[model samples]
Target: IGLSFVPDLKLANSLYALGSCYNTIALIYTKLSDHLRALEFHHNALAISKRIDNRRSVAQSYNNIANIYQDLEDYDSAMVYYERSLALKTEGNDRAGMASTLNNMGELMLATNRLNEAEKFFLESLEIKSESGNRAGEVYTQNNLARLALLKKDFPGAEQYLDITERTAQELGLLDELRVNYELRIALLKELNRPADAFRYSELLMVVKDSLMNREKAEALAGIQIAYEVSERDRQIAFLEKEGELRKSQLALRNTLIVVSLIILGLVYLQFRREHRNKEQIKTLLREMYHRFKNNLQLLSSVLSLSARELTDEQALQAVRSSESRVNAMALIHRKLFERKDEARSINLRDYITELITYLIHAYGYHERGIQTDLSLEPVQVDIDKAIPLGLIINELISNAFKHAFIDHQSPCLTVGSKLEEKATLNIEIRDNGVGMRPPAERRGESFGLKLVNMLMNELRGKYEVSTQSGTRYVLIIPL
Candidate 1:
């Protein structure tokens, strides 16, 4: 009758009704364990449901197909269909269907011996079922939980779950569920060493089994074989006819798709070329900007130097020279960035420090003063943001040591070393073999260079320690 109506149906509602009828037939075949026949009916139902945009029926079809695959022990295929059904069911907010799918997933997990995952699914299903007031679903979920508890050797937990399931099944007069509950009770009793109780439950199970078989046998035996054969032949003919129509439609769609695809491909190629050219232009612009910035900084340093030559006061000359050193430090960073091929914001600290120290020695006439410098720098890169502050700190400390620390000494020695400490921190130590720093009370006056070092250290989010034993030693630690 459903097939007869399919030909006359022009409305979506009629098509949906026809799809539901086919789905019912598929479910009946599934229950009868005729998976191939079930598949044919399910496919037909799915086709009609999708055509009418009936999401609920589409989800049902996916679930029914998954059940057939699960029964056939094709777990991977079953999982795929199950996931599809779950997604659609969730989208439609079908609470009961979600609970059912969750229960099915739990059963599959139990079969695979994934007891923990099985329990999780069962509990989730139970929550949904209980919220929806589905006592039957709750009973089913309770039974699954009992089975999981039994596998985990939690006899008391299993007993607790089984008790609830058994009571509910008996209250609802769900004979099929009662049989399952009795069987579980038998297993539990045997595990508990209660042979008499086990035997009693076994007898109960057998009685329920006989009663269920008798009730189902008459209904299952009613010309089912002939009906199944006839339906199978009809399904095959309908499938071939549908396939022919689908092929014709697909050919027409393919021609249209090919032309659209070629146009899209051409647009994508043009966009890619445009983006590639834009990126190259951006890189060139960045390089030019860095270059111009470096030149400007150099020009500023030269202006400061020329101003220092014209200065009469020693204090004014020292300030000018200090400003020039800072300008040069910043210029060197921009110069390194411009020279580097890789577009990284960080500069190699080892190379930067080496060059800066060399320039400082020459600027201070320290090399002519017979001051020997030893560099023990480790290979480390620091970002420009932190590097500038670190460079300034080094400049202040080295300049202070070169000017004052070697005043009485004939031969002055300065050592700058860096090392990577634990926790990805960079540790720098600058030591000078000369007179040590004055006592805290004596050095109470705020020295501009030391204050600047402290300010820069704070900016870098780092800490520094100064020791005045034998010689002045400055230790700095900064995170990477």
Candidate 2:
């Protein structure tokens, strides 16, 4: 019906509406678990969204397609779609959408038994949900956390998470989340050898299931009623159109068009002036926002530093410091943007990386350890989206080297280099003159740092290779 209203199918509004319709149908099929049909509609939605230049819809289509792939157990495909969705959402600064995609990715990681990676994604989602005051989303993440804890055999931790989730889910009237909480509760009780409690939860689970079925039936009936009403409204419109056949005078139409054109021209001139002022205002606001963001990150880094200082366990302190470094890396990007006086969105990679290495050197006490630094980088500019993740990747590689790669080396040296290859790819090398590091395959199931690196690499659509012959040499190839 919406398509019929469009006299020209090539119009932007028509294409955007068609994309929305496709998205709606795709989501409906997704809920029905019809993977083939869902993917077909989602791909159509994605194509139309791209044609209309509707980025938000494109991100949503990607996320919906990822959900279908995940249901079909195509994890690799799901991950790729999820990453694309996340990148687009991040570009738009859509925090709510980002949280949703993060939660879905966390579930994918959990299903694959990458527990540590799952926890990180879950925590990230939870943090965003909490900050956005999304109580329902926060409860859902807590339930995921409970499931994660159960998998790790941390019964007490699982119970703590379930307790919070159950209470919050009920408070929020989140039926789906409450059902999930009940299911996890039953599992937790079974693991604890409390058959009676497990059985009690099983009964409650059935009641919730029945309630959900009734809610679904109600929604289905409502949809049917809406369809009937729309049909009747269309018939009435057709009847009214047949009854009244008034025609307009061609002279009046021509006069109206001339007046409308004059009005549009005047509005266009006013719009031009308004847009210029708006652009200036937006730039000023962006700089101020960047400054605030950088300051907030610095405050977070300080808190992490203070927390690390208070920690007694070496491993725990090191973990806190690693997190602090990651925060610092992200903060650096915003700081650069804040300091830049131009409207250019790209940051000079040479200056950014050189300053980053210098900070890391002091932060890790490379000088105190008699460690030598070698920095070689060609001038390249990257937008904030790529810069933040690249900065984190560099931080992790260099920080890992400083902490572990130089355990017993007499003459420690770190080499950080980057160069543009044929004006197409950016080749980055981080090498150390210390003990060789383990390959990704060996530490794939462990190492939070490596998990983060893999995720960031995916975000950048980059490839990497590790050589452990002389020491640890990480060669990252990122397309420009």
Local accuracy of candidate 1 as per-residue lDDT tens digits, 108-204 = 8888888898888889899999999999889988988988888899987988898778767755556667677888888887887756346545655
Which candidate number would show the highest lDDT if scored against the true structure? 2
**Per-residue lDDT for 81 in model 2?**
99
Cα RMSD for candidate 1?
25.9
- Expressed as tens digits, the lDDT of each residue in 312-359 for candidate 2 is 999998999999998898888888888999644568898988888878
TM-score of each: 0.47, 0.49
Show how many residue pairs clash in every candidate, following the order shown: 0, 0
* Distance from true location, Cα of 88 in model 2, Å: 1.4
